[model samples]
Target: MMRIVVTGANGFIGRKLVRALLDQPSLSGADGAPVPLSDLRLFDVVPPEVPAGAADGPVTVRCMAGDLSDPAALGAVMNGGVDVVFHLAAVVSAQAEEDFGLGMRVNFDATRALLDACRQSAPDGAARLVFTSSVAVFGGDLPEVVRDDTAPVPQSSYGVQKAMGELLVQDYARRGFVDGRTVRLPTIVVRPGPPNKAASTFASSIIREPLNGEDAVCPVPAETGLFVSSPRRIVANLIQAATLPAARFGRDRTVMLPGLSVTVAEMIKALRAEAGDGAVARIRFQDDPRVRAIVASWPARFETARATALGFQADASFAEVIRAFVEDEMGAPHKDPVS
Candidate 1:
């Protein structure tokens, strides 16, 4: 029986990950699939809504709501016997840039404290730590195609903090304190729920707006290209990271995930194909230079051969991604083409 602790259990990716874990059948060992969630601990700022029949099973799911920035709170959670720690908590890009101090505290300082706590909790090496990094780590003066060997040139405070966290996780892993894997996720699109304050919030909004019969504004031009992965793909990669053999990852502690590299226009075209042209017409292009500049600085494409070789996969096209959102989150096929 493996004990798993997941932070940010209420956020977009976190919630979906937990649901998938809970629904998973019996897990395997080293030569097989991952071990099942016999004892699972979920921590977040807010309590997550567990599945209806979650409590009726053999797996014991415990929920803890607390501020990770507080040492005392983090200590209490880490004190529990934990085998796997999924560190997903962080301030998003736009919000982090807005409040530099808060970003530093929540993104960097708190993360360091958590890693230290993991070290202290399992002095004999008993846990696997998985950190959710972002593509924001790459910025300014990028080539046409970014590879795993690309030097990190973070442009925002959030990117800097996330990059720092990645270093810390790798260092801790190297010390044999915990088996750590850092995954650099692209902009996760078609995220469920209302829009967040992230600079990348528009990524989700562009899909969510039309689904709800509302119009959305594109801050960047139609030709603007970026890397995006659906929420399902993000969850799948996270699970793979947790289960992948450390020997397979080698010395490269960080991995860039696979995603669809498409322009805003292409994304709209896919949406229309799945939904309809009316939904596409609902999208209004209103350029905001500030947002455009921030997005433009990000890498438009990546060679995720490392992740693919490790058996991680992403959607083939933007339409497949949209259909995933519709099937998994929307609960039904699009009634209106715009929807």
Candidate 2:
């Protein structure tokens, strides 16, 4: 029986991950039989709308809302004997860049505090912690294709915080305080919500807004490219990261998950292919240099050999990405967005 804790459990990826975990028969234990989850604690700053029948399964679902920086809040979820921790909480890119202090408190301080809680609660050092890192951790004169060995040189505050968090995770794992694995994710495309402060929000906005019958703005040039993954793949990879044996991670635990390298023009082309030319027309290009510059600093190509070898997977194409969004979010008989 696994006692699981997911911080940021209300966010886009977090909510989806919680749903997946609840539906699964097991967490893929080594004994051939599945490891049934006994308890699932979903912690977020705001109370997440609990999914229908979330608590009706064999698992006990606990919804918690509190500040990540608050000790009492961390204590509520980390009472003791937490088998796995999916640390998904963080201040996102542009939001962190806009408010440095808030980013530090949530991304850095809160993360460190969570690690401490895990250390104290699981004195036996048996907890498996999977931290959702970002590609932003790599910046400033990156190679054409970043690899597992590529060093992190973050430019933005959000990137810096993630880089720092990665280091802390490595050190904690080294000291045997926690078994930590950091999966550095690319920009998640077709996120199922309205635009937020993330410079990359336009990536999702271009497809999601138009599909939802709204006009959308593109802040970067048509040729601007980014490394991206779908929400479905990310959620699956997050669970895979947690379920794998601790020894499989070896000495270094950071993994750059596989993603599609897509330019804005290419993405629009895929959107057009999926939803028609009218959907393409709904996007108006109005470049924001600040957003452009921030996004431009991130590397768009990677040879994720290590992640692939570890049995992780990537989306087949951008078309699949868009289709997945439509089917999952739109409740589709699959209507064309232009219609």
Candidate 3:
């Protein structure tokens, strides 16, 4: 039997990840062997809504809500020992940029605190910790196509924080405090909620808002390219990052996940193809330099040979990304989203 912990459990990715884990029979242990999941603890700033059947189900589920910076809160989640820790909590891009202190508190300091907790008491061995990072970590004189080993020169506070977190994860794994793996993610598209403070929120809004039969704004030029993945691929890759044998990582613990390299124009084209010109007609372009400058700093293409070799995957095209949102969220063909 194993105990699992997922921080940021209230967020969309975190919630979906929890659901996916519930569907699983077991998870890979430190020994690289599958073990039955005995308990799952969801930790977040707010109480995460417990999915149906999880409470009385075979696997025990516990929901915890509190400030991650609070030792008492961290202690509650850290107690009883943990076999795997999926650390997904972070102050997103624009929000972080807007408040440096909050970003440092959540993304960096809290992350270090959690690692210390795992080091102090893990499941008789190091815990398998999967850290979700962002491509925003790459900036300034980036190669036309970023490689697995591209040096990160972040241009934003959020990027700097994530880059720092990645370093800590690598160091922790190196010190034998934890078996940590960092998966640097591309901008996720068609996120299922209303816009947050992320500068890249417009990426999802352009498609999601229109598909939901609403007007949307595009704050960046159509020519702006982005390296992106779907929520489905990210979840699968997160699980993959956790289960893969620790021996496979060797010295380097960071991986740039595979993603589609596409332009905003191409994305709109795909949206139009899927939902028709009506959807395209709904988007109004009015550039906001703040949002544009922040997003433009991120590298838009990568050669994820390492991630691919490690069994990770990416969406085939932007069209597939749209289809996934429609299938998973809308639950039916849009036929006429504009009605």
Candidate 4:
């Protein structure tokens, strides 16, 4: 059985990925089918919440909680044989900018350390590494639709750190130290949790607030557009990145993910349509200069032909995204927003 190690196992995407990995069946080929729960090593700052019935079987689960920034901590975790490593731990954009030092240490330095550890462990070169990057890598002067070939001009400290990590991933892959793939993910909307420090937190808040019977403030104008994906879709893409045929990617080290580009107005409209006018009434516009400036610098749309050609998929529309969040995350009757 191939042992998989997932960093950030307690995080939103990380937790979901761990559950998915645990549920995978053993003896299944990478592309053949899902692997079972018995073959995973989950690492995070906090222990993940395992399913209630998971303890009934002969599954092997190693849960380690520690600071990933420490070389010794990572060494201990990477000591055992690892077949794949999913790097998802990082400081979000807003928080990263707030503390540049922490951002560099966790996002860039820790990532580099992890890759180094992976290289040292696999003396024969035997593990696939998937690095989760962000669209924040592109900013400043951007085209209306960013293409796969677009050069990244990161505007925030977080973006710079992620972009740097992508470079390290490419360098490591080129040296044959690890089979690395970096995916530049879009802002995941309707995230299932309390508001995080990401400037994009508003994207999820508009949906979550209405669900919890509270009002949400839209910091950007109605016409402000941005790229977004649902958490489920993001997890699917990450899994695909790990299992897809290397031949499809060719020499490209990083791939842009396909995402829906919508404006705040469009998002509110979708939420209102699904929940009701009363829900819409719960949302009001309140602009914050810092958030507005940061969000405005981000690319509103992307042309991800490369990712599409490789069989990656995205949500069809923001409405469908809202519906998926309502059904999957909220678990409530789909209510139409009160107009």
Best lDDT among the predictions, by candidate number: 3
| Candidate 1 vs. true structure, TM-score | 0.92
Question: Could you tell me which residue pairs clash in candidate 1?
Answer: 275-337, 276-337
Runs of candidate 2 exceeding 4 Å displacement: 30-33, 333-339
What is the C-alpha lDDT profile of model 2 across 81-197, one tens digit per residue?
698899999888878988999999999999899888888887776788899888888888889999999988888898899888888889998899988889999889989888987
Question: Can you write out model 1's per-residue Cα lDDT over 265-287, one digit (the tens) per residue?
Answer: 89988888888988887788899
Better of 1 and 4 by TM-score: 1
Q: For candidate 4, which ten residues in a row score worst on lDDT?
A: 21-30
Whole-model alpha-carbon lDDT for candidate 3: 0.89
Q: What does candidate 3's lDDT look like per residue over 5-50, in tens digits? A: 9999988899888988998858887677789899999999989878
Cα lDDT computed for each candidate against the true fold: 0.83, 0.87, 0.89, 0.82
Output candidate 1 Cα RMSD. Answer: 3.2
Higher-scoring candidate on lDDT, 1 or 4: 1
Q: How many backbone clashes are present in model 4?
A: 18
- lDDT, model 1: 0.83
Using Cα atoms with residue i matched to residue i, what is each candidate's TM-score against the true structure? 0.92, 0.93, 0.93, 0.91
Clashes of 3: 0
